[model samples]
Target: MSKWTTANIPDQTGRTAVITGANTGLGYETAAALAARGAHVVLAVRNLEKGKAAADLIVGRSPGASVALQELDLTSLASVRSAAGQLRSEYDSIDLLINNAGVMMTPRSTTKDGFELQFGTNHLGHFALTNLLLDRVLAAPGSRIVTVSSTGHRFVRGIRFHDLQWEQQYNRVRAYGQSKLANLMFTYELQRRLHNTQTIAAAAHPGGSKTELTRNLPRPVAALSSLLEPLFQDADMGALPSLRAATDPGVLGGQYFGPDGFGEQRGYPKIVGSTDASHDADAQRRLWAVSEELTSVSSPVI
Candidate 1:
């Protein structure tokens, strides 16, 4: 397939999009692309400086691009709620919801809510945001919700039902992998739930791109990662699959899109497959229940 770049993006004029973690990495690229195409991009980020800088960067690229920075910390429920409510108040309807922010292998850490950092930020936070924004998303005719997962998810055995928090064994990498897998599972179930509804939900991954998503790693580990750049796709290239997943009118619910390359690592965007474990209905239901319980948020007005 030919390369997919932001310049080639189809027109998204008048559409409003929300992208979590829009400050850097694939998230910034994704938001940049959408904003370039004339979509109003609400960048939901935890850091005010970085978030505003990202929005300004996008606006700089596209002079008339509409970009807003909204404070959001996925690690905290209070933060998420305030941001969600603020977003609702700002825009009557959200045409696109991109759950793009994530955390990685850090020292064994947890969110303010005490859940594993990876699981809380990557999966639960986005899950709650999507559900909370369901009203605006569904309220818009033919809207979509896209959750960004990772190829790293393939490394996890599966999301552990009993120890969802990983309180027992604290291997950061495995925990991160499991959390990403949970993201994919959440995407699957959300699409299932949106069946026959106006909103469509799909999942995508940025092909092994070098980005700030790895900031949590140790200095030594980070230096070792430089070797990955040559082998990994660029962040803009990596953002293409997500852009496609988010903007492709042909995209369907439950579809999984990613780079079509060796080991599913780095290449152009295309629809791909997920592991069987990602298809577990039981686990999805459990996750939904646990997410609502943990976040203490109300069910959205779907």
Candidate 2:
């Protein structure tokens, strides 16, 4: 296949896209590219001021770009609900819902709901957001839900059902891996649930891109990142796989997209595969059940 950059993104005219964490890094690049291509992009961020700033930047670069801002704090279930309600009221149909906002290897902490921070923000948060907006997304013609995961998922073998939240002891990297793994599992299960609908579910990874997500990395990891910064892809390149997963007409449900470079890092976007554990249907189902129980938000699609 020829190189698939943002330039290859087909016309997004008339589509409405909701991108979490659109204020910076990969999410910002994703929002900007889609807006430039004629999509009315909503920057669903935790901070309104920052969201507006991102919107301004996008509009500045791409004249006539329709970019809006909406506040969404993924760590808080209430915030997610409010954001979803506001979005549903505004858009009759949502063409794309990108579950892209996430936290990395932070010190052990819990979210507003008392769940593990990384797992809560990265997986459960998006899980709730996507379900809350499922109706709107399903209403839209050929809608797509793209969840952003990471190569770090290889760090964990599978979901630790016994200690899903890492409450006993939290190793930052391991927790991060579990959360990302949950992201893939969530996507897989959601696709299965929505198989009969026009709304499809897919996933993508940024492939070791330089982004603000590294702020929470461990000291050693941070130091290593600094040394390897030169090899990391820029945010725009990192956002390509997500862009492809969300807009690629040929993309199918349950498929994953990532970089084509060595070890699936730092290159053009392409359809990629996930770990065997990630493809475990039984585990995916269990995660979904646990998620619905934890968040008390169930998808009508299921």
Candidate 3:
């Protein structure tokens, strides 16, 4: 199959999309492309100023692209819920949702909701948001949910069993890997649950992109990353998998998408195989139950 690119977003006319962390990086690129294709893009970000700035940037680029901003802090369930409520009130149907915001490995820290920063922000938060907006997604046939994961997920040992919250042990990079694993697991289980149903749920990973997601790296390490990053792809190029996963008509639910280059690092978007843990249905089901219990929001039965 041909690789998916920004130019092939199916002229998203009349569609409505929500992309988290859309102020910059792959999220911004994704939003800009969707809006340019005629989707009414909503940038749900943590920083209002950056959100407005991103909107302006998209408008500047797309000229007449319809874009709006909604504040969202993925670490806090309260914040995610509030943002979803606002979106539910403002829009009747949602054609796409990109669970793109994330935090990479960093010093052990807790979010406002007391979960590990990485797992909380990257996995659990998107879990809540997807469930919260389940109605809107189901209401709009052909709607899709695209989650951003990482090739780093293969290194993960899967969700921490006893200390799922990472209270007992904390390793920055491992935690990040676990979170990304959770992303794929979530997508697979969601697709399983929505089986015989409609909304598409898929996961994509951007090839090594020079984005702010690596900002958590300490100064010395960051310098090394900067030196190495240029050898990879740019954020706009990196967003192709996400853009394709979100808009491709041939893109099947539960399919994992990523770059097709060396080791899935840098190339055009194409179907890719995820880790074995990602296909663990029992784990996915357990994670779903835990997520619902933690978020206190069950997915809509429709």
Candidate 4:
């Protein structure tokens, strides 16, 4: 079968999409393609200036694409709450929520909330945001939530429940893996909760792509990004799996999508399998409960 592309995305007219960290790279590409296809795309980002520029670029290319900008810093619960409240007031319903923003292997640091940067920003932030916005999403017809995970999820064995914040010791790669694994677990658990609802939850990954996410990696590993650019796909190509997960009509709840190329790196989007660790039911439930407790946010379903 031929590979799926943005050209296959159905007419997204009348749909409203909220994308996090959409100022550049894969997030920008996903927003641009969706806007071009007639979705009213909201670039939910940490940087408003960059978000506006991204929105302008999408309008420039799509010639009147419906695009808007909203500020969101996932590391801070205050910021997430403020953004969600504002969004809830402004938009009556949200058709798609793309938890696309993330941080990589940065030096050990904590968020404004005092949680580890990666775990806080990548998993906790999205988890809270999705739950806060669940009402709008549930109200919309054919709505979906697509959280972006990564191949890095395979690096960790499982969610370290006792040391979720990496307070014991910091292995940047391992922490990142735990966060990505949480993303998948959250997706599946959400799907289970929404089984009776119209809204569906799915996950996707952009395999080996050249994006600013690598800016936080160690200097040596970061440098390898450019050297491996020939092997790595560009941001637009990398955005395919996400774009597919967000817009594809045939997609089912709990499905995970990724690149179809060698080693699942750099190709068209296809349904893919995650690591055995990512599918742990007990882990998923525990993480969901722990996330709610940590963030002080509750899932709308329960």
As for candidate 4, its clashing pairs are none
Q: What range of 10 consecutive residues in model 2 has the weakest lDDT sum?
A: 1-10
**lDDT, residue 139, model 3:** 88
**lDDT score, candidate 3:** 0.89
Worst 10 residues of 3 by lDDT: 1-10
Error of 4 at 149 (Å): 0.4
lDDT of 3 by residue, 151-223 (tens): 8798686778678877876778788889999999999988887777688899999978889889787577678
lDDT of prediction 2:
0.94
Weakest 10 consecutive residues of candidate 4 by summed lDDT: 220-229
Candidate 1 Cα errors over 4 Å, as ranges:
1-3, 218-224
Which stretches of model 2 miss by more than 4 angstroms?
Answer: none
Clashing pairs in 2: none
With candidate 2 superimposed using the best TM-score fit, by how many Å does residue 297's alpha carbon deviate from the native?
A: 0.3
Tens-place lDDT digits, model 4, residues 206-295: 999988888788877777776877899999999999999998899999999999999888999999999898888998999999999999
lDDT, candidate 2, 134-226, per-residue tens: 999999989999999999999999999999889887899999999999999999999999999999999999998989999998999999989
38 Cα displacement, candidate 2 (Å): 0.2
Task: For candidate 1, give the lDDT of residue 231.
Answer: 86
Candidate 4: where is the Cα deviation over 4 Å?
A: 223-226
C-alpha lDDT of residue 84 in model 1: 89
